[model samples]
Target: MSLRGRVLGITLLLLVAALLSSNGLVIGQLRHDLVGQVDERIRGLATVAARLPSLPEVAVEDVPQVRATVEQQLIRDVHLAYLGPDGGVDRVVRAAAGRPPELPRLDAAAVAGRGGRPFRVPATGGGDGWRVVAVPRAGGDGSLVVAGSLGVVNRTVRQLTGRVLLIDSAVLALLGIAGWFAVRGGLRPLRRIEATAAAIAAGELSSRVPELAAPRTELGRLSAALNGMLDRIEAGDAARAASEERMRRFIADASHELRTPLFGIKGFTELYRMGGMPERADVDASMSRIEREAARLVELVEELLLLARLDEEGTAVPLHLTPMDLRTLAADALHDLRALDPQRPVTLTGPGGGPPGGAPVLGDEARLRQVTSNLVGNTVAHTPPGTRVRIGVGTEDGVAVLEVHDEGPGMT
Candidate 1:
């Protein structure tokens, strides 16, 4: 069952049980007290009836006068009857307000004048039952009996039960209404937490349960705990995203660097296959260039492997700075570009004058060479065959400069 249903159901059940138990106790107690009063009155009237014949003003043989005397002493619904030696209802004197009840066959002890205590009899003609007492009449051969009906007592108890039940039903209904709202109010925070969990499952890692009133309450503490957990989850997700981005950039850079060397080697071998290196010195120079590019490829792989290890240790990759010449790097690019596309016109120049010159600087030579080759490769790939290109190399104001100029359409 749902939380609201369970809570309301239990609350109502306990309340109804308590109300019913209380009603039983109250009605039972009231009936007991009322019946006790009836017993006392009948006992007094029965005592009076037993003693009337002994008084000089009354005779036991004068049934009418004695009956009148007993009736004058009677309480409401009290009736008198006489039992013979055979324990039968020998004669009965009905009262003006009520009649006698159907008395059962007397026990031996009562006919022997031993039944002084009040006893009960079943109802007759749809009437409520009776309380009766029997005693031996003085100077007579039979017993006298007095009885009082319980109809008043029964009616009073029924009225009380109806009132109590009505009141209890109203109270139970009110409690149920109030409890439903109270339970709903209490579960509101849990509903919000449920929604947050759903949102998180749907890939909104940043979703969180809202704050509650204070951490002292159970739900408030739960919301705070859930929000804390969500914070950690979002942080972990962001860290994973950043790591993925770094790996992607690392792989892209690796591919670009690896491609440069592979292209140079392929170009030189292809030129030899076409028998374009007609002179022996031409073949030697191209072979030497191929060997150098291959060595650079090995160095690039080592550098990338070092970077991966340092990244795992959460350390930055350091540059390999040393004294280097931009002109040397530029001259290497000029040769590779000319070999890759012999139809393209390539040149080397000093930025200050018109002739190629050294542009010395402290830098990573392999990284610098890779960057220069990348620019030259971009120029060679985009420009058509026979497009003029320039590799400018010089130092100005202590900063080494290397530039690649292409006579082709510029990027949009």
Candidate 2:
């Protein structure tokens, strides 16, 4: 079921249970009090009839006189009966004469034994029922039994039940209506949040739930959390887009660089094949040129592969890490540079200049050496043949630092 339906159903169920419980209590109490009053009246009437002056003087054998006496003393809604010395009822007298109500046959012995306590008996006439009080006569030969009808009590309770049911139904309906509106009003913020989410899902990343009127409420907190999530998603998407653009540029640059070397090799090969290098010396020169371009192409391809691997697997590059001195690596790179370009004036300084002691770093030795060599080689490659180059290695900010400086024209 919808949330509103569930809320309304639960509310109505509780209300109905409470109303039923209270109504039952009220009706039960009312019935008890009314029946008690009827019982008291029945007992009182029995007492008065027993105490009548005419009842004590009457002879047991005189049935007509006994009936007449009981009829005279009877009050409204009360019935009086006489039991003979035997267990059977002898005569019955009512305040108003009609078809008399069906009453229990009383035993004279049982009536005398009871000591005037009232008891209940069902009427055979099938209506409300009766409250009976039996008392022994003064002479002890018989008993007087008094009964009162319960019709008034039953009628009053029925009327109360009808009224209570009607009021309860009306109240329940009003509460249901009020509760529905209250629940709907409470959930309005949630509905707004849902709409905002729908808009965001439709590619409107900037869409967000509006600031809540009640910021401290649960729905308000939920909206704030959702907006924070959207912000993160937007940031991640922008980063991804920028990364893709950078990759596209990098691929284009790599292709151009590779194409230049490949085109040189192709031209050299075509000149040799087209008989443009007929002399042995010309053929040797052509092969040498082709080898140089092939080497350049291979270097470019390796660099491209390294870049691709780094991008694909993040920083988890294969390395045989060992602690090695940065100074040793720098000295080695300077030596190699001097060998490759003998005319370039090279100098080693800092800790690597005088002794072996230098700042150490944990890394793959080959990769670290390659990196150092590349730095020094770049300096030599781009500078004038007579330029002076200095390779420095030391510790800075508790970290190993390597610096390559050359007295040459730098990149613009």
Residue 269's lDDT within candidate 1 is 95
TM-score (C-alpha) between model 1 and the true structure: 0.80
User: What TM-score would every model get versus the actual structure?
Assistant: 0.80, 0.63
lDDT of 1 by residue, 45-84 (tens): 7776776664332233366655564566445566677677
Question: Could you tell me which 10 consecutive residues in candidate 1 have the lowest summed lDDT?
Answer: 52-61
lDDT of 2: 0.71
Question: Where in model 1 is the C-alpha error above 4 Å?
Answer: 1-3, 48-75, 82-99, 102-116, 124-127, 134-144, 174-182, 194-203, 308-314, 382-384, 407-409
Q: Residue 316 CA error for candidate 2 (Å)?
A: 16
Q: Which stretches of candidate 2 lie over 4 Å from their true place?
A: 56-76, 96-100, 112-117, 206-243, 308-412
lDDT, candidate 2, 319-411, per-residue tens:
788988887777666645654555678877763344333678998776665566556656756888888887878876678877778888898
Q: Rate the local accuracy (lDDT) of all candidates.
A: 0.79, 0.71
Would you list the clashing residue pairs of candidate 2? none
Displacement of the residue 26 alpha carbon in candidate 2, Å: 1.9
What's model 2's lDDT at 189? 79
